[model samples]
Target chain A: MNKGVAVTGIGVISAIGNNTGENYRSLISGKHGISSPEILETIHKNLPVGEIKISNESLAEDLKLPKNHSFTRAALLGAFAVKEAVTQSSLKIDNETGFISGTSVGGMDTTETYFKDFTQGKTENSRYVRAQHPGFTTEKIAEHFGITGFVSTISTACSSGANAIMLGARMIKAGKLKRVIVGGTDCLTKFTLNGFNSLMILSDEQCKPFDENRNGLNLGEGAAYLVLEAEEELKGKPVLGIISGYGNANDAFHQTASSENGEGAFLAMQKALKIAGISSESIDYINTHGTATRNNDSAETEALKRIFSKNLPDVSSTKSFTGHTLAAAGALEAVYSLLSLQNEQVFPNLNFSYPMKTSGFMPVTKLKEKPINYVLSNSFGFGGNCTSLIFSKNGG
Target chain B: MEVKIYINGIGSISAQSGDLFSGDSARIYQENIFQAISPNYREFIKPMALRRMSKATKMGITSAKIALKEAETEVPDAIITGTGEGCKKDTEKFLENLLDQNEKLLTPTSFIQSTHNTIGGQIALNLSCKNYNVTYTQNSVSLETALLDAQMQFDEDPEIYSILVGGVDEISEKITSFRKLDGQLKSKSIKNLDLLKEDSTGTITSEGAHFFALSKEKKQNTYAEFQTLFIKNTIQPENINEEIEAFLKQNNLDSEVIDVVILGNNGDNRYDHYYKNLQQNLLKNTMQLTYKHLVGDFDTASGYAIYLAANILKSGKIPSVLKLNDIDSKTPKNILIYNQYLGRDHSLILLSAV
Candidate 1:
């Protein structure tokens, strides 16, 4: 039990791809998924967004849901990804299996559709009302998958997915559950589109993580999940990677902005490294939390430099390909980190034309192959919530 | 050695006064949805910072501060919050304004406060306590999940001394009314205090915020030990007995050892049986208590149950107003809080005298 947390299976559906295969191909071949909003209906048609191409109706049909089912788009995406993880890992989901989901806007798509109707005495659409809460979507996903065990939803803004994974690993280590399905789901909605736009952090063009000319982030929609099994229960199962370390720390600096020195980010990485019982030099790759925003990139860069001062590993952000998926970003990149280990390849950071002056650290902009043993991924969210997860090559 | 978790301080802003059950009868509720009794707020928060906060943020911050102040601790190692429908008012406001203004010229205040983690983020900013921060939004079991997380923290990191954990849910005009249509709310307006007597299909609704400063180092004011907690996404109404037995067995206790059982029965005809099955069967002879009739039902209303247990354990006396069947216990020793929503998100919490 003291060895490590084993990630037996991983599943992800992002703007770059519908499944892990497509996402991996798109990643290595330098295919970018950022484009104009096709699935999301917004006034800013010219604004680039990393939106999944499939519609809710198509997603529901893919899941074989009923016509009048109450599953929201986010639930559909989560169920879709979780199905892949469960199937890939050959995992048995019984009464002891736990489902932990991370979502910021749970079912707001349904709420926005039925809110006005509810106010006008249209009571039939009331089922969508409570679904707006982040927990409802997790419940819907769990119900869809028949995961009738302990279920919890973490909604710590952007770091939610990483936190969900952290909690699931903790629960497994505590002998609370034998296996757990953990990840996050979020769909691009007009509410978030307008909200991030209101904050003036919505970039009109493709996001450039760690680039000097980075302006802001392009909101995206996606979901990813991983099957974490107790070390004893694995029983010779094919371990994709090991969740060796996880750390969480809040910036406590501002509501939506990071501090000048990225205190929370620094502490999060430090704690994660300490938990893994490994030194900074042991990390082969670092998947950074580069949102491409003016505040986030510079702050993250500064934090990265502080943690890996003497010898920096190959660092990169895949946000350029998938955009910032908000709550799903952490889990999405976790999949990428594991993919890098499984394939022994490095995915380049797209659209980074120039390096920032603060850190002066340019991300690997070209696909390359190398032997990697450990990878560290960070996800920092609004409300100053920052989480770092260390995924190491199995049997490392 | 087993690390122990204790409830050192508690702050609550619910339908009744925060300092409830102070040698007096509990306040009765007549409305369908009970609003929390709010404090001055200015006394705890600065004016400039207070102006921008929504009702949920205000309640969360003020109650967190009260708990910290009472515990005599300045900063906690971590801050965790459980919110069912977080900042619903702000969310509705942002949606309405976005629709009205055609998604243009919208401000970020309502949008910022609308997120589920705003309260946790704001509390961190106010206290400048930068440590592990997370929020759970899982309907009825939200607060229980927070407690479970804190328990796990103590077990995983013995160095972690204290964590600020709480649950907050605010009622809004459109959202509350919308829930009525889902058959979750009572069809007709009835006196909430007489909720159990009602032959209705749904229950009353309400708003509240409750925070607690939990620590491994038991202070002089420690009310009770947070012995154990668990959350089941669901269980059949008929199968609850076995689940309770198993949970109790896990904690090395049974119904007889539980001196007081706090039941979250909001009088929903279909689901009240979940509580009555215990009130009249396994835990029937044990002292039974109910609180939703007074505070009305909300997602995180179980937080009040924890408050009730802590206060009862500290005072060594049960408030007669919360009595259900009059089975008496001279001094309440061990308390169990069981809560669920519409037959889903079942949670069990065990609190014992420290």
Candidate 2:
């Protein structure tokens, strides 16, 4: 059986920064991207969000597409990220390259805009009729890169992107595809803005992860992708990091809330550590999915306590910087984790003032330079979907 | 390297009524376009939790519970699901509120439940099973994709004892209207039993949830063994026979050895030709049967066909209502299911009686 999958290339677009370099620079500099919504036309303007400064029109222009193209903001961001990853990998688009993308909102941006118009007998924008479907968005990305083999989309809420990467690794291990590009993308929309506001989870101030004053998560928009290749395909390509282990588990607790004990997160971390064939102490850092919400931080803290009895590694939530990018959170954090491994540095959980009274866990408050070997990234989404991914400096 | 994955238990909540394991006899709607089967979810879910769940979540959880109960397993190794338009009811609710409220004071319950993975996540939460979770949303091939993932898990990890896999799809008024506007749904309603006979332009749309407990270890209740599955984004009508032959060959089986063939023949005249081609050339002499007529057509409707094939293999009895032709067989063993939507997302599933 294959030992490990090589991560050859990476791409990202988040509130902290657009490209990988900008994101990394912002991470160590402790720059927070959370702000009031300016681009998204939502009544929840006071609510904090990691809104991208660029407009959809400008994103399309950057991609050099026709003016009347039906590319949704989600598609535009996804294509941009995938283009970077593919270019960096130096891989040709052919039948051998597999495209696996994850998204929760798909084309909801376009669908929400045209929902009423379409019903009013307006036939002007029928091109987006199928955009609401998740598969349509994935197909757009696949077609953009001229990829024709084994394309699929996963829609597991926030954990979608991490699951996509896990599936790509399994496919490579199965010898199904020689090269695979896996990641996730999502764009801010009034649909999600109002959705989170309705749930009363949108924080009014900058999110304070793992802090006693934490309120809730701040929604964000962006896309991130990674190109993973089989061992033989690696040849002389510089490997960024090795995807050594991954796991998924369901809490089956509630539709929108996590359980008190963080059962799903605990199981997912346990399974991932088992798959990586390493002890908990081997993990030097953890990029938490800490959305700074009451339910998520507590549950995740409990999960960590259960998984690593006494020796929990340095943990921090980068969502403090980029906000919670829904489907792209896992991928964005993955890129950050690889960066941490390469630079042997840990990004601080900005805006944290005090530790939570219940969990009594404190995240890395300031940027710390340390020799890091393995990093565990966690992402949990609605419907109790929890996923954990472990990246190692060397092939496990 | 070759490991056998068996369907130990099956559960479904579709237009046709009945709990998991009970044949589709308690309630079967005769209308072409029927609503989903409503279950007393209180038994499986709490009232507070039930209040927030959409039709997709309720159906998925109830069916998953039934499947797990039948298999007598408390926790599964993984939870996987597939849906085309997931949580449509919530999607519509949230969208309506978004436009009506003009993006003000909208609650997150509907929006949170509206994601495609909500059902899978809910099932995982309900079972407290945290092994490996994934969801697929590949149009008509959604369910097949979930099945393929389960099969891969079984082949790769022998420790994975049981995996809960299912597909769900629901219809909402706005999306349904849009589909009708797009000429996707049938224009005129016909009897559900007579869907195939109607030479219409579109197929009847419906919703359902089908869950199966798949494992590497076979038991007495094991329904059938999943052999292989293949999905193609686009396939020409002329290439249908060649594709089937090649797939069967890869599995070391030939067309003549197939005992039964389940076809997805929704009343859509444009795309029904794909099934007709297979019926006429590839498996013309094989025992042909169909189920979309019984339980309208949807993205994951082929899941119903898999349920029926599994039961048929287990009982060795063919229901008269599902028979498409009179090529009778004393004992049906190897079964192949072919399904596609709008001439795209073609999928082939092979199963054998355990």
Candidate 3:
């Protein structure tokens, strides 16, 4: 097998915590971050969300940006996550580094706020007009990091972050660059709040992932990043984990809903296992893409059954802790997966009391300490994009 | 060992035609701001699923079906898509409803579809081909990014036989109007046929979906062999020549070997210099071609360029409408497509006649 991509460093700012250590503490303690909307100014205040407690102004101030900075909430979160990743990776911001970011709504937070103002001759908010496109958000992040080479963005819904990681690995394997930082960021907005509300998938209660009474998902906002480096370039660094394998597949079944059999999820898991040169039994834990929606939990359970047969590994949906962070979900879960491997722990799938009737699979509802080696993470999104990423301890 | 990836099958839904093979024979739209002739999406997608799909998803699914049919492949090893604006219809719908309703009682469907990867995800959901699916949205290079991913899959494993790849974009009323306000779209409507000659400051906005079934093994229906694809985030007009030279040298080919050079010129006076710089210098002697006049300009418009290149390579015949220069070749053998948007997301794609 090709030498796996080295994940030298990671950074995260999610609802559960900020940065790697904080998030790990929350995950291990089974502290669910779901709370009634505090930061997001929305009419549906009853709906729970995994919102970062920081305000945009506070974030901007923390980044030490100029007062007249046009950075959107998405960019702000992205900058924070990326800054942490860069510092953790200890890589100099030079011409050689590449930045690939995944974002669903690049600057919708600012655009939504400024859309009508532009018609009223508000030139100050007009700067956000160009930021609506996803590339502009990534460009802003690249600019902040002083990166000028191979900068790009991927916008594959929830799987965008995973796909970004996959692309970074491919670029490194192709000998394109020595180091690259890849991940995704998204700031919850009234646009997404109402968008998901219209679909009637936003649960009023804390999201009960894999629970029989699970109503729907709680939308969250945050950013997470992983710094992936070539093996030779990672000399003497603390390798957090290794991105052993990654697979992406399309459900091709519907626009938003996954298939009954979870074909895409199954295929992604299978492909990832193949790439990692491991069997289903070797996977010690699974970070499911269980949004607690009736469709997602059932479909994902079925997929797990198909991949693992009778002896499935301990599985949990961290969405209970962080909600569904959309594009950041993949990277967030990637960070959690690495933490699980590092700590040899199995995080609880909060609010899950009963298994879904279809797959009859139950999640690990209590934190358990064990010898964890390999962890599989799944993130599926609209347009039936399914991605599975396998992370393993070094030399596992 | 390296594997040669071939364009086994192709499909598209644009201003030209929804059918891949039939696009060349399709009627030429002379209007500048042409919209895609949407197919009967209900025939392909179920109502429950179709209710929430935006124009981008519908176009993406329909074109993906056509591509799969053309290749006669039931399932591909991977499904990857590139989109620039991604699910604009839903994005607009959600935004409009939010602004109009004051962010009350909105649904999740529009927001879910608004994600750029939704088209790729929806296609995967429809096909149940859960292999390797990704969506790239790097401005104009969105489609090229997907193509590059497909190429990497082929290079990584020869066992990866077939990959479904495409680029899609859609225009919504509000977004299109705002784009016009920002001078991204041409102010005046001009005939599509006269797009090149028009002295316009911006491009006529349009949308399209182009899907291709790429495989390592060339089949009877293979359109062309995708040789190499390159992308650069930024390029200056002065550096265009050097970039092209270096790109060709890295690919172990030269300008003389390229039979056709498809340029992305959308009648924008400001950025048209990027194309003019190429036409006047490095590729002056090459048989130049252009297509945005017919399809208008969008992020993934380069997909249509790929469609055009594939057709020329397959038929060995150049349509009279696409000719930008009189430099003729006996038969189109090698093709190079270069595209960008607002002078960013620069991409170069090379296709060879198989």
Candidate 4:
């Protein structure tokens, strides 16, 4: 097998915790961040969500942003997470260092607040007008880090973060960049919350992944990032994990739902395994997309069975702790996968009491220690976007 | 060995009709913000689906179908799209309703289609091509990023023989109008043809979609060979020429070998200097051309520039409306496309006659 792309550092901020350490501690402690919304001003207060308690003003203050700074909530959280990753990697930003961020709503929060103002010819929030585009949010974070080369943004719904990481690995393999920061960031917004509620997919209780009685998902807000470097650029740097394989495929099935067979998820997993030059048996654990929505859980389970058959590895959905963070789900789970590799432990899938009826598959409901080498993380989203990433303990 | 990429087919829906570059007279708009000339989307989309699709989605799907049909490919190996402010109409509808209705009794139709990847995903669903799909939304460099990804796909997967790539953006009612408050559009009304003449603060803004069918294999109808692409998030105006020179030199070429330079000049006095620096200095001898004046300016307007470059290289004809200088090229062999938005997301795409 070929040596994989090296992951030097990782950072995350979610409902469970604010940083990597806090998130990890919460993950192993079975702490769920789901609750009624407090920070987001929405009428659906009874609906449980994974809302980060920090306010936007407080976030901007922590980042030392100026009064006139036009950072959206996503940008603010993205910068918060990116700062930690950059610090941990001790990376020196340069012209060859690229930044690829995945975000779905982007600055919709800002847009929602300022739309009426702009229509009334108010220019106070005019700076945020451009933030409506996902790339504008990316540019704000890139500027914060002084990364001038090859900055871009991906917006593939919930799969955005996974796609960003995949593109970074592919770019490194293609000799396009010496180093890159890849991940996703998304904050709760009335737009997304109401949208999911309109679909009747937002659960009023904590989501139970892979459970027969699971109702739906609890929306979450957070950001996570990984610092990926070319092998030659590492220069004795400590490697946290290696992104050995990645794949993306379209279901061409439906807009917001997966097929009964999870064909897209299957193709993505197969392709990722092929890229890793490994077989299904080599995977030690699976971090499923497991959004807890009836269709998603069953479809993902079917896809998993198609790949591993009776020899399924230890699988769990960390979303039980962080809620469904949309664009940030993939990168957030990726960080959990790296943590699993580093600790040789599988984080439990919380709130799951009964096994899914159709597949009758059981997930590790409690933290389990294992001799894990390869961790595969799945992220599926709207527009039939499905992606799978394999992180190896040792560079393969 | 590296595989060669060819631009075999192109489809576009913009403010000007398809005949704009085909020797037909161009339509001049006097408004600051204009809309694209839409096709009979019924010809491409079914009534049920069309009812749900926003203008951006309809334009994206139709243009993609036109491109795929022209390339004579039933299904592409991959579908990649780049959109700026994707499905804004839908996004606005959802947000407006959420605000007005206080998040009560909302529908998911508009919200489901607001995603930036909606276009790419719809194209995949239409063709039932469960192949690689993705979307980029990095503004002016958005389309260039897609092109770069397409180039890499050919190298990453041997089975990916053909990929459909495009850039799309559409005007929204309140969102597009917000540009006026932020100075993204001119404060005064002006004719589209006279956009370049006025020493203005902002250029006229419009929306369009341009799709290209890129394949690894050369065909009899190949328009041009995709040569090289370079993107930088930021660069000082003074350093732009050096960046361009270095980029061209890395590809074993320089200013002399370039026969035509398609510049993205949107008549913004503040940022047009980035283009003017090259027009006056390094590329003075080259036959310079521009297209934003005709199509208006948007994040993906460069798609029209690429369309122009590929057509000119294939037909060996230069449309007079795009000419920016008196210099002429007997047979344009190499064409360069340079674009940026508000002095950021700078990109360079080089195309050569095969």
Candidate 5:
């Protein structure tokens, strides 16, 4: 372990890519994954989303599951990403390897499909009843990997994945576990699509993060994981990067909306900087929470100006590519942050044309190669849960 | 790096109401489902806030306040919570409206309250404690995860003083009824007091909230000190005793040193054998206690056992109503709490009198 909590390996499966390499390629090429609804059966066909082309059947077949498998689409996506993470890390999942996952809609895909059927006397798929719980998907993943220790799931809306990573680092720093595989996964369902639609936050067009004319965010689904090993457990292993600091704070202003000044966002960034033992001037890049919603972009920009002052780092919101993946957005961006560290390059924020009038800030519109040292990624969610994770280059 | 963790205060709301240690009344349960005998939520929550919260959020906030007041702490440094089917009423409302309206014209209230961390977030907002807030939702082990995180908090940070850790779940119409179809509930109504006598396939389903004010510094009214906590995702029911013995050995305590052994027994004929093996063998001579008969079985029902254990430690007295065996002990110094759900998420927690 070079420094901080060592991040040994990472894996991701999203609309833009199915693995880390694919995601990196797409990120460098500025390939936005936004498209019109193709798989989801909804009334609004014009709504754009970052939908993965693969079907649940293909995902199940990839895992060689039986026909009567109770694994939900979320669990399948989680398993797919976890498998790649395990392979990349070559880490052994034993009694000591804890697993922590973040998920919003754990298995709603299965529950919504069979809720009426089971309640109306159909009992063939009754095993899916427990899928209503978010922990169900985590249980599926833990069982798949044969992990038996300290398994937990966090659901703090969109900031869930970042909080999961935060807890993992805290666990390691506390000397509770020697190693852990932490991440998050969530699959799109009618429940969330309609939930966001009802909130009137779902955009009908491709999301343009940090753009002045951005109307709303496009919902997406995916999963990602990172292997974090403690100092004692790291014996000359290939470390991707080090998680230097993480902070979580609540806005306490609204149930679902961010404050105009982004108080929670500002506090979270300050706490992270203090924990990392660094100053704000050291952050080479910032992966903002920008969900393409007007409120989020405006508030986050104000928070950025407050934290970084006039000299803001090269900031971009990756949601322009992945369309806010809810719980998985944090970890997905964490992987992107690590990719930035390893390649010494900054990925551009796609689809951003105009700058917001209030903040008068522009996200990096083109990919830039630079000497990256540390990157800060932000994930804000409903209930005013704001979390920021800072990743430092291993040798830096 | 492990440090001593003490249960400075405790609060619970279930079929048995008020302070868990206080002798409230002759508790009786006639229905299979045990709706919590609630306190006046208005006393703990503001009028504007209480209107939007669901049953789970209301119970969680109220119980958390009771615990904090008992500990005489105004605001905890951190708030950690565990919930399985979080905000069930709001989830049901949102889902029902979504399906009924074909996903149109639905308000964001229910959707906003539908997340698993609503209770934890609401508690933090109510207290305005921005230290560290997290929520765990791993089925039955939800509360255990929270307590473990609390222990981690105290262990990692030298300055963190106190934390509010809780486990809560709520029951709604559609979700509870659907659970019946999944073979998670008893086929017929069984008297709550006679839960152990029946050879039933499933146990009764219910909900409640339990919160604890845990601190590194023990006060005169400290309930108990946490010794160790462990979890196993899956262990064979037949080999549960081995797990318990191993956990005890690792903690450097023998089985005989345990004055009270709290077991989670809900009379599920399919899974009660795990408890029977422990009660009849290793812990036969110790005072055995059961509480699901009074609290009903929920995801975080084991939290009630911790509340009971802490009271026994603080008062040096065990209520006769909770006694499963007649083992006599003047003071219970060490208590072991073991719980599992459907033979998964098995956990063992050891506590000692401060």
Candidate 6:
């Protein structure tokens, strides 16, 4: 039962890149994707975001969807990413194959745009009426691949992607599924832009995750997915990495703010390590949930200190490059974690000059090549949802 | 090492009151859209905290508390919730204000509470249970997804004994009305009790929250045994009989052994045939029951069916209002529930008397 779930392939489309190869290139090259909104029609032009430059029309056209299609931005991005993963893995879509997607806003972009028109009695875009549900986005991607089994969507805010991956792994482990496409997708929308803006956490510049001088986070839009298959299903397929363990916990502290002690993060990480049947010392790299917000960074640092008291693993926040892609953050980071393990290198945490004074823990500021075996990725979100996943190089 | 899971307790806040399950006459609503009969939230939650919550959050928390209290469990090992259009009232409010104010001068209160996981997170906060918590938002199968996760949790961890799981969905001003524009709701005004009687294109819409406290160890208050459940994204109408047969066969049970079959027939003529096909063929001889007629249709409307199934198994009483056929059972042993919405997200759940 402890046999690891094999990650056969990974796909991602973030602000920095449109595919896994491009994302890896941007990550190691120290290129950040944070920029002022270009395609997203948000009034917060001053706010920086990891906005994908591709427009919805082009994405639909590229996907070969009809003009009357109800593909929302999130659905479009999700399909765009899933197609690559399915192709890379050479996985056959069948009744046994399942699809689980994590999304926060889901199709909110389409809803926010067409809401007024619908209320004013417009029916031209009524196809998007049910698009607000996160499952709609997932089903769109599922429909594209003709997958008709065990489709579900998780919406635990920012940690959604990690939770989705975790659920997929658990399902495979439980023998409920043999192969499943699992990940998360979200796109920039006026609703989320203004919502985060209302929280007063929108950083006007590139996000500086875990940096002492970090002001806030830059919201990003993207989608990422991993093809997880059981050992029996992988006859000759190349394994990207192995999802050895995963854990989910709630802070139960506050609705929005994390606990000061990072209790949830600590428990989640500890649980992941226990599930992976390894000690904390075995982890070679840590992909932090470091959203660069004051509360999150400090709490996560505290959690890290508790877990790795003496020798902290080479830690970095890839969100610095992708600018906290919300629901897609964990899947994007999962792909990055696989990249780190495959290349035997750790991606740098961009824009980190100094650590917080309270917790003077400095993150890896430059790309470092090393013998990486185990990678632990953290993803925490609103509603105090915290998830941690352990990826093993040797299938554990 | 398989552990038996039992439904220790159930709490529901739906269109009809609790008395309906106790053989009271059903409340008739002549409208296509209805809301849950809210309980006194002050009894379950502090009034100060209740003021800021949306109906979905209030119902979820209160119902969860009810289930936990009934189970005599202080804190569960995990909490999982499935919701469709979570906190839509708050989401709509935040979106409308954001648009109305033209991205100017907006508060974060509504936005903060609008998240899909707010109910699960809030239940955790209220209980101070820092254990595993998650939320699923998969349309009609949301509750089934949570149940599937809980089932997996039991298989993975021996430490997890009790889990609080639920399905919730609420209506909003702009968002719920959008269903009418999209033909997801009946165009004509229909009575709630007459939901299944009318030949309609869309089912009546409503909001509800149902919570179940599941435990590995059965207690005196245990309702029934949660045998198993299956969820599939899509299936052909013609293949449903075979699907049910396959599921039953997988569990070492067949139609003859089934006592009561709870169907999710919401009166949408286009989709009702799926249930009609099953009713005439596979489950024709079985005692048929339905609950969406009593509680208006929503994504998690099947939660009511589960709640009803548990209660029926425990008390051995088949509420007359839910009977789809005159087939009677003095003490039903097995209950199988099959539900779907708009011809997608089909689910099958099996429960048996303890």
Best by lDDT: 4
Off by over 4 Å in 5: B18-26
Estimate the TM-score of every prediction.
0.99, 0.93, 0.91, 0.99, 0.97, 0.99
The candidate that wins on DockQ is 4
Q: How well does chain B match by TM-score in each candidate?
A: 0.98, 0.96, 0.95, 0.99, 0.97, 0.99
Which ten-residue region of model 4 chain A has the weakest summed lDDT? A1-10
All models, DockQ values? Answer: 0.85, 0.59, 0.53, 0.92, 0.70, 0.88
Assess the local accuracy of residue B171 in candidate 2 as a C-alpha lDDT between 0 and 100.
Answer: 79
Residue B265 alpha-carbon offset, candidate 6, angstroms: 0.6
**Could you give candidate 3's per-residue lDDT for residues B209-265 as a string of tens digits?**
999988877888789999998887777778988999999998889899989999999
Candidates sorted by lDDT, best first: 4, 6, 1, 5, 2, 3
List, residue by residue over A11-98, the lDDT tens digit for candidate 1: 9999999999999999999998988997777888977999999999999999999998999889999999998999999999898899
What is the C-alpha lDDT profile of model 3 across A166-277, one tens digit per residue? 8898888877778999999998888877777778888999888888789999999989999988888877899999999888777778767888998889988888898888
Residue-level lDDT for B324 in candidate 6? 93
TM-score of chain B of 3: 0.95
Q: Local error of candidate 3 at B233, Å?
A: 1.1
Better of 4 and 5 by TM-score: 4
Tell me the spans in candidate 1 whose CA falls farther than 4 Å from its real position.
Answer: none
Q: Write the per-residue lDDT of candidate 6 for residues B281-342, one digit (tens) a residue.
A: 99999999998878888988899999999999999888788899998888899999999998
> Comparing to the true complex, what docking class would candidate 2 get?
medium
Clashing pairs in 4: none
Q: After aligning candidate 5 to the native by TM-score, how far in Å is the CA of A152 from where it should be? A: 1.0
**What lDDT is reached at residue A263 by model 2?**
91
Residue B99 in candidate 6, Cα distance off native in Å: 0.6
Q: What tens-digit string does per-residue lDDT give for candidate 5 at B10-101?
A: 88888777454566543667777768877899999999888878999999999999999989988898888999888888988988887778
